[model samples]
Target: MEEKFDAIVVGAGPAGSACGYTLAKAGLNTLVVERGKFPGAKNMWGGAYYGPFLHELFPNFWEEAPVERYIKHRKFSFLTEDSALSVDFTTKKFDEPPYNGFSVLRAKFDRWLASKAEQAGAIVASGLQGDDLLWEGSKVSGIKAGGDDLPADVVVVCDGANSILAEKAGLRGDLSPKDMKQGVKEVIQLPREVIEQRFNLNGKEGIAWESLGTFTKGIPGGAFIYTNEDSLSIGVVVQLNALAEKNVKANDLLEEYKQHPEVASFLKDGKMVEYSAHLIPVSGKAMMPTLYGDGILVAGDAAAMTLATGLALEGANFAIASGAAAAETIIEAKKTGDFSKTTLSRYQTRLEQSFVLKDLETFKKAPHFLENPRLYEKYPEFVCDMAEKIFTNDGKPREKTMKLLKQAMDGRISFLQIIQDLWQIKRSI
Candidate 1:
């Protein structure tokens, strides 16, 4: 007979780690199985993490976690063929304690987090990919992995974005290609002093820049730059369907983005460090899978919690928070010995009650809205053209600003279309 535990977490990411930590802290038997050689061995992100959730899980997380830098500034830019229209902001409040966000390399952070769970008493085993869910008459009985099976009253799937287990169990369906954002990322290295001097940083303070311009070559994705301790993480994410339709290869696009006049300046002397690619669940609300099944719960990117709002790709916080919730729900299920869909549904309720669901539901349109073809192609060009006209002082009397704006709109977008766009923007955003 397979040994039974209170809970089994399949995937030692933030969500799984959080759940395991909670269960173990409650003194219940818990086992976490991971496919990677170590937790986060395969995870990647353009990755920005909100610090509060981690701080809540382990107070003074900054004192121990492998964080890159504390971000105090954020920049957004519109890029054209030659010029850029940009806005930048810096706040000292963000530079201090209770820092809002930080950059991370998923590999180091995820492993550290899983270790925390282990210390808290959860058994964490790597290279044990969650292979199948053992079902006893429509109820999740346990998790089978690494050619062996272990029993559990409840199993949580935090297996991540392209979860084969979630789909096989009929909790999620195959993802539509258009619903995902395929991204290629590279971490570039520069000397610490060089980064501080170039970005004007003080100690561990950092800056982040996000762009919606020529980065994707109008294929409907964006580029981002974040300052790390001694390196810069920069990359582009494009809509997959748009790429195939445009006959664009992912690597070639990254090369073009890096060479753009505005983007190139930042990399003047910085050397390329690491290159990686991963898929992101870009359709926030539209893509979420069923939250619960008999004795099973889903969290993190596996549940489609990443919000792709303008300039922000948020998933890590969602991972940690939802993971905690799943853990808490299981504790209650353990008390009543009722791991049926009815009892396990509490995980869904807690997740929905948390900001994880509220925020994701609120910005349901942002993912597709940012990817809307017109915003990627028409608006950036229109803004650039308008900027070109106003900044041009050729010694001749220039047309009125409104007249220039109209000219910029003429061939690119019609007056009627602009009116419709404004309405859609107002409604969706």
Candidate 2:
């Protein structure tokens, strides 16, 4: 089709759809070209959808969007071979009107968000993967897909992790294995009532858990369990090089994780329903690519914008927010009839101004800190050993805590090493 659009969005994810929806709603001719058979047909997430950002674009989204549950509690457990040290936070505040966040299946959510864009007049066309951006004198002019060229004044590539377009456009360099994370997750099924009673969830209120410490077999990765209505999303995220070097199968690690005394109980009656895995970039702020260039802007995972080291993993929120800012920038450029590098640069400037970039910048060292090996290996074993000794009652003589601590430290780590770890942690976080 020999046609042109005001903007073309690549990838029908949160970021792409948000930009498409905003531009279309503002009456800009927008086209969303997705590679998948349908929007979100191939996306996988722990299924957490933070609300306000979506609500800002589609008010009353909860009433229309396919949501699994409104999260009421969050739990993080540090697990060892046979034990777990955990922390939990629950509040009814999340149950109120403006809910905090909800569990979501990316398959349904991505389609729905794209549909919203379609509803707002954006032409969301699927099965057309944006192979590359069409250039006009050092500036992006449009996109080429499936032997057909679709022209656009501005192109927003929300192409997700392993973005081919970003590299083709010289927006990102080759992604190193060390800079990526391999995530394997399974959706396990159970009767709703059984799940509700077992997890202490009433109605749609659910729990989320992130685990570390020996879960990755001394590898720099972590495990997690997220509760849904009648199923649970459980998985592990390991740094690529860590997993490759250990020659560990992600499934095997998952099996061991489920065998842990703390994890076993949760899977007692649950049956595996679906298996999924994907790689995410999480080398911290250093891995993020240049956000924009002449006539083109990148958002979402394509830009390596997810915060993997936090109380909760954040990708969708950043995706939508950056997408919106990109749309805002495009609108300004459109008004001025200038899609030049100088005018389009507002995309980068605004992203830096937003909390998405700021937070990613702030936690820049967090991924490296979390990958320090000790947090998941040495400290956990040490902590579990201390727990065993402190709980033992038939000791010949009660040992002082300091003596026990030093003894524990002496084996694999030293006092100076622990202190240095502490210092590095303080500096990173």
Candidate 3:
């Protein structure tokens, strides 16, 4: 007879580990499976995790977690071919305890998080791929891995954005390219003091910078630079459909972005340490998979919980929240000895009542709004040109600001179009 567990979580990423941690802490027999040699070995991101979700889970998690730096500064820039305009902000409040966010290498963070689940009594099985689901009739019963069946009362699907289990469970179909973003990042090593001095920081203070413009070649995505303790994570995230339509490569765009004067100034002596690429689910409510079914639940990227408003791209917190909610729903089901779809559907209700779904629903229009081509092409050029005209003192009679604005708008973008775009931005973000 094969041993069965109360719950099995597929994928040891943020969602899976969080789910396993919560379930095991609740005294349930839980197992977490990861295809990678360890958690986060196959993961990559811009190197930042925001919000208080981790604190809620571990209470001052940053103290013991392998966090690089706390973000005290943020910069957003619009880059034209040869010029840049930016908005930079920093505050002492973000430097206080329980900071707003921190920069982290997923290779370190995910392993630590998986360890937390393990310490809480969840059996973490690394390098174990969950190839298929075991079903008894119409209900999910367990997972089949390495030609062996591991039975469980419930299976939490936290696989990833490209989750095969989600499709096998009839929760979602093949993901559309138009709804995904491809991110390519390079971890550039710099001295810790050099990183702090270059980005203007002191003692664990860090920066997250995002740029939009010709770098992506009008592909409806952007570039990012995040400061780690002794390194920088620089990358570009571009829309998949747009990349194909424009016949452009994301890595080429990253090279172009790196060569930009504004960006190069910060990377003078850095050594390239790591390179990675991954897919992101940009469409929030648009591509969301079915959250629950009989004997199964989906969370994190598998459920399309990422939020990509033009101002920010966030997903880790949503993943953690959804994982906890899934565990909570299962705990309730265990009490009633009912693992039916009706009982598991409380997972969706719990998420709906929490910040996860509320935020995604609130910014549901953002993804479509960000798809506008003008944002990646014309606006950056117009803004930079207008700023240049305003600041340049050529010893001629000065033109009014409105005249410079009109000059910038001429042949690039119309005032009515700007008004409409502004309105769209208002509604979307």
Candidate 4:
């Protein structure tokens, strides 16, 4: 295929398909290349798709999109060996149109999204591995894939976190383990009614549960479970740097988390359907790579767009937003027929003006705060112990709340450490 196209997007994940779909919708020749058998065939997420990016492209997307469930319930937990302390919330407003988020299985969701690009006149080539950027002097002019050179006026790299094409094009440098995370997950199948009963959900309603502490063996990471139609997605994500210190494998961490009483009870009688491992970019804006250059623009995880603020881990929304922004910038560049760095620099400006960059910048200090060992270690233990102490009833005289808190915290964490962590959390979030 020697045909020169207007735009070639590598990796048909959220970012690539969003770009390709937008470009195609605007009457531009767009081609999306995916390494897997199809889009989402190799992709995985924690089952949450946030934001209205999809709604912007296809109004009322949930009506036909292969969404699992609208998230109406949310829970966060702190875990110790034998106890759990949690905060739970659910709202009826979240179940209506333009819901907050939905649970999704990438294999199905990505394929449906890529089909939208195809329907919009974009060519989606699956099973095509993007090997390297085809360069003309200092600028990328095309993509080299499966021994064929596919030319395009612009190349958008959205090939995920460890984007080899982006790195080879000098758009980003090597990533530090400190800024990366390793995730492993299992998809467990259960009866639809069983799922509803287990998670306490009604029709089309779902829960997103996240926990820290014992799950990671004290690593700087956490575990999550999202309810699907007839299944559950359970996983653990640990910092790459902390993996070595924790001396535990990703699967091992997941296994340990599964044995926790609170988690295991939900999975009873469920059959494991799939298992996968992935690399996650956890640092927010602080580690974002160069956004644009010459005829090439990088979006999604390639630009380190994931946000790992303790309260949430967000990527798909950012990817979708960045992808749309890249397409807009490319549209502007096409108007002038200039794909140089000066023209493509508009992509950076667009992102800055959008929530993609703003949210990242807002939580720029989050990665450091999340990395504090005390959070996943002593803090959770202390909280859980305090909860256990408060709830446990004995014949002996009861201790005051302050005394109970002191007892749980003393020797586990220093007083100064608690104050500092609280201050850091305040400043970071």
Candidate 5:
């Protein structure tokens, strides 16, 4: 394993695979080391892969990739105990090529992506975990994995949200539970036609649904359901600190979410086939680690590159874009034969110039805004209460919508509180 390569990519998820594929495509000797038995074995995501980043790397990827469905609509649900309120957006244009987004199973998706890297001439070594970083004084020289030190001129660390190698290399400090989230999901098996019928989806079309309210026990988190080809990916993401404070297990919250009438309807007659959980960094760019150092670059979740902007939960897109940016920087360094921090700083600059950083910066206040308890508690309850009033037609004379809105707000929330919440939303968004 002492064989040196032009670049070594640790973690074969989207970010690592993208970096490996790009470097190898440029004829650089590249190696990908994955800790899992195979790429995506331990990876889990909420299902949608957004934007044009992946298309730039692999045009017509959906044609050959193991994509489950193309998302035709985005639905947001607000819930109370017995009631559910939602908003859905569907565009026919999104159904065309280079589609809006696709529902993916990470295990299958990552393997296909890793295979693409192999096809592009990168060596992929799976079932190998990087124990520590091999360093030359202040520079990262290679990766120490499975009792062997594999040398490389530059190392790209995309080792997920909880990255030990980044810490060992002094690239970042320990992650705080306050800044992370625990996500628990179940892949429910159902016939493809059955799933389509339940979700109102057509051929290869799917819906991405997210909900907020009593699901997480008033915790500052939410639940999601993404339609797959023959199954449904349903889960709940709860703030780690809130989970601890409430002394509730993530699985318990997911169970309660499943029992909700709205959620139960979707899972009717569906059998649970797989259960998985993960930790996600939700702190946006404020919690990000140094993007690059001498001979080393960190991309994807390892650098806290996830964006939770209320409207959408984005990770794969950031991971792929960051991986490409890191590869571009390394290619430049290889041309100059210098892997110094000064030259590698281009990785950060490239990310900044791209949508990866621009989008993150745009919604930097999201994490903090999400922390407000009112969002997951009072606001959803109020909205559902208002909806109940408006829709429940009684024998008596009907009241105006504005009157129902006032009735819903009265006693529960004050005018000042409403104004403050509105002001915060305006400022944060």
Candidate 6:
């Protein structure tokens, strides 16, 4: 006799683990399958997880999770070749219980999250690839993994940005370079005290720093530095289409970002311990796939659940939220013993009612706004130059602030262009 489960979750990342944990805890027999040697073994991100969904699932999870630090400080910088203009914000509120965000190493965190599912009675099968979806007529029945047909009532596709299972189920079509971003990252090890001193952090409080400017060589993405317990997660993310048009490699851009004066200062004496790269689905609703089908649902990057508003970049929270919603929908369907499209459609309804779809819809124009070339090129240069002019001591006579602003915009942009850009920024973000 063949074995069967109530649910089979593909990809043991945040989304898969959350769904599996939720289902198993709800008394449903769940199975989580991963292609990597272990959960998160092949995962990489900018190093921070935000929002309150995780706490809702596992209260005070940070108390036992492999989290590196609670992020209480955030900084955004606009950089030129040798100068940088930054906005830094820190607060004690973010340091309290149920902290706003945390810096985590995916390899450790993913395994820990998967273990949570296992502890909840879900059978987490790592090193097993979910090859394809088993179907009966038009409905998904289970998964084909490691040459075995593992039958299940419902299958949740939590695979990463390139999800073969979702594609095969006709949930998402081919992803275009225009809708994706390539991220290259490195984990540089440093002493704990040294890291705290350099980043101006205390205890487990950390910082997330983002930069946009010449470092990307006019690419549409940006650079980020996240503080960890004894390491720094630093990297560069760029739009795939823009990178190709400029004929530049993502890794080469990352190397250039590290060599920037302001960036180099933070990584001085740090030893590189790990290097990784991954793709990000950044187009929000524009690239979103069909969320649900008969006996099938997609969450996480597979469904383009990431948000990339100019002011913030988020994904983990959305992934976890979608996972929870999917689990709830499945649990409800289980009660009726009907795993058809009509029953599973509740997954989309749940997402729409939650922040997952709501936030994405609210910022649906962000992707188009972020693609403006001047944002990655001319704006940073103009801002830094304006700052230099305003603060220079060698000036014979200091000009008014508006005059300096005009000087900065002289050759780079026009007043009308600034107005237009600001208007778009307001509309999008």
Candidate with top lDDT is: 3
Summing lDDT over every window of 10 consecutive residues in candidate 3, give the lowest-scoring window.
45-54
lDDT of 6 at 262: 90
* Clash number for candidate 1: 0
Q: Which lDDT values do the candidates have, in the order given? A: 0.85, 0.86, 0.94, 0.91, 0.91, 0.93
- lDDT tens readout by residue for model 1, 148-227: 87889989999999987789789987898788888898999999998988888889888888887765777888888888
Q: Over the full model, what C-alpha lDDT does candidate 3 score relative to the true structure?
A: 0.94
For all predicted structures, in order, the TM-scores are 0.96, 0.95, 0.99, 0.98, 0.98, 0.99
Model 5 quality (TM-score): 0.98
* lDDT value for model 4: 0.91
The segments of candidate 4 whose C-alpha lies over 4 angstroms from its true place after superposition are none
List, residue by residue over 1-429, the lDDT tens digit for candidate 3.
889999999999999999999999999999999999999998998878999888999999999999999999889999988999999998888999899899999999999999999999999999999999999999999999988999999999999889999999999988999999999999999999999888889999999999999888889999999999999999999999988988999999999999999999899989999999999999999999999999999999989899999888988889998998999999999998799999999999999999999999999999999999999989999999999999899999999999999999999999899889999988999
TM-score of 1: 0.96
Structural RMSD, model 1? 1.5
Model 5 lDDT per residue over 1-429, tens place: 357899999999999999999999999999999999999998998777888889989999999999999999899999888888999999988899999899999999999999999999999999999888998999999999999988899999999999888888888888999999988999999999999898899999999999998777878899999999999999999899988888989898888889999889889999999999899999998899988999999999999999987777889989998998999999999998999999999898898889999989998988888888888878888999998898887888998888888999988788899898788788776
Candidate 3 wrong stretches, greater than 4 Å? none
Instruction: Rate residue 139 of model 4 by lDDT.
Output: 86
Q: Residue-wise lDDT of candidate 2 within 1-429, one digit each (tens)?
A: 488999999999999999998899899999999999999887898777764777777777888888888888878777888877778888779888568888888888899999989999999999989998899989999999888888999999999998889999998899998998888999999888887888888998877778887868888877888888788999988888877788988888888898888988878878998899888888757888888888899899998889866454688889999999999999889998898878988888898898888888888888878778888888887877777677779848889998888776777788888899889878777
lDDT for position 382 in model 3 = 93
| C-alpha RMSD in Å of predicted model 2 compared with the true structure | 1.7
TM-score: model 4 vs. ground truth: 0.98
Residue-level lDDT of model 4, residues 245-274, one tens digit each, is 657798888998999998899999999999
